[model samples]
Target: MFSHIILGARDLAALAAFYDPVLAALGLQRMPDEDDGGPAGVGWQLPGQRLPQFFVQLPFNGQPASAGNGTQVSFLAASREQVDAAWAAALAAGGVDEGAPGVRPRYAADYYGAYCRDPEGNKLCVVCWG
Candidate 1:
């Protein structure tokens, strides 16, 4: 029911740097060689997906990293190791730790999840289901 998921950012470059590795760990490769310079300044595709390939474009009007409240993105990790790696990387890359990586026995005995706010305060999560 959705065409594509595009987010407004204050800086496409920084956002890409933040997103690329985390998504890649999930087997999503950054689409290469596609820049149109339109409102959607650039695009990155996750090849061979069930739905439309995902893309990230520059915010047409305002600055990049304009993520607002009520916005959250979750990337799945293959194992708890990945979740820990993601959390560490995010912290090094200017993300604020929202929740530490560990099993949330309250949520579920094996619900391992890590949460952080991106440079723009968007709630991003890396979760592992063991």
Candidate 2:
């Protein structure tokens, strides 16, 4: 039951470019918003809804953005193949690999996932349970 998520980045434009294909592989798109303006923040919606957006931006306090060591944002994939594609897209976009796409048995037998860090070190995972 989350409404939205905003990921802070040091370079907003680069972050957006890096995430474009990664999210597109999961069928999400960058949502258009003219009012949420402040720096280069952009929101990506979950296909249909306008709210519950995901944003990447520089810090609102005008400080350098830092990644939380324990924080991770995850995107759901419709299938394991999409998870692999997402991982490849991330790496192609200059992301560092945290974990390759595979079934993480520790999480679940069907928990297929891939982990990576964005250019600014934000951790993310593309996972599939179905």
Candidate 3:
């Protein structure tokens, strides 16, 4: 029953720069033109879908970042390579490795995945070939 997701970033410019190429690699496109009134930067849209669009706005105005505050956001990949690439990209973007990429039979026999904390410390994951 979810409609959309928005995350707060202390640095919109940094977040945008980090996510642009990384998400694009997964076929997600940044919404064009709109600049959420400047300080509140906006982007984040999946490719080829006009509806059910999701956007992530940056900066929470001095509020504490809730990145890895026990919250996890997982993205699916088409193959193991994508998972690896995602992990590397995330690390390059200031993501800290929470878990290395591998199968977690406890989650599922084929649950191949990697976990990381975003710049804001939000727990994130990428998975594929599961």
Candidate 4:
């Protein structure tokens, strides 16, 4: 449904530090530094695929990066364990907990997910559907 999703960040290095491990937990690998010369940022995508990338970078407007209210990005996990691992990685990498890993029956009978805010306060969710 999307080509890519980019989150604005004030600190590119800090964003990489937080996203590297967290995305790894969900089996996403950071793309090699091709230095596209577009902007200062980093991106990650599922191994061996090209589209649907996730990126964190400075705002193009040259202003401070701020999280949009009610905005969120959700990633699909292969299993509940991946959801837990991603959540753990997020918190360990300077993210804050928004919700712990658990079943969210309200979403679905097999919904298991966790939520956290990135170091820059962007909301994220890791979810698994059994």
Q: Highest lDDT among the candidates is held by which one? A: 4
lDDT of 2 by residue, 1-130 (tens): 6888989988888999999999989888988756656766877877777666788977889999999989999998999989999999999999999999998999998899999999899999999995
Report model 4's TM-score to 2 decimal places: 0.96
Over 4 Å off in model 4, which ranges? none
| Candidate 3 lDDT trough over 10 residues, lowest sum | 51-60
User: For model 2, how big is the CA root-mean-square deviation?
Assistant: 1.3
lDDT of 2 at 98: 98
**Model 2 vs. true fold: TM:** 0.93
Name the lDDT of candidate 4. 0.94
Clashing pairs in 2: none
Q: lDDT for every model?
A: 0.73, 0.90, 0.72, 0.94
| Candidate 1 lDDT tens digits, 39-74 | 644444457654545556666665544676788777
Sorting all predicted structures by TM-score, with the top scorer first, yields 4, 2, 3, 1
Give candidate 2 regions above 4 Å deviation.
none
Worst 10 residues of 4 by lDDT: 32-41
**TM-score of model 3 relative to the true fold?**
0.81
Q: Alpha carbon lDDT of residue 93, candidate 2?
A: 99
How many backbone overlaps does candidate 2 show?
0
Clashing pairs in 1: 9-64, 9-65, 10-63, 10-64, 10-65, 11-64
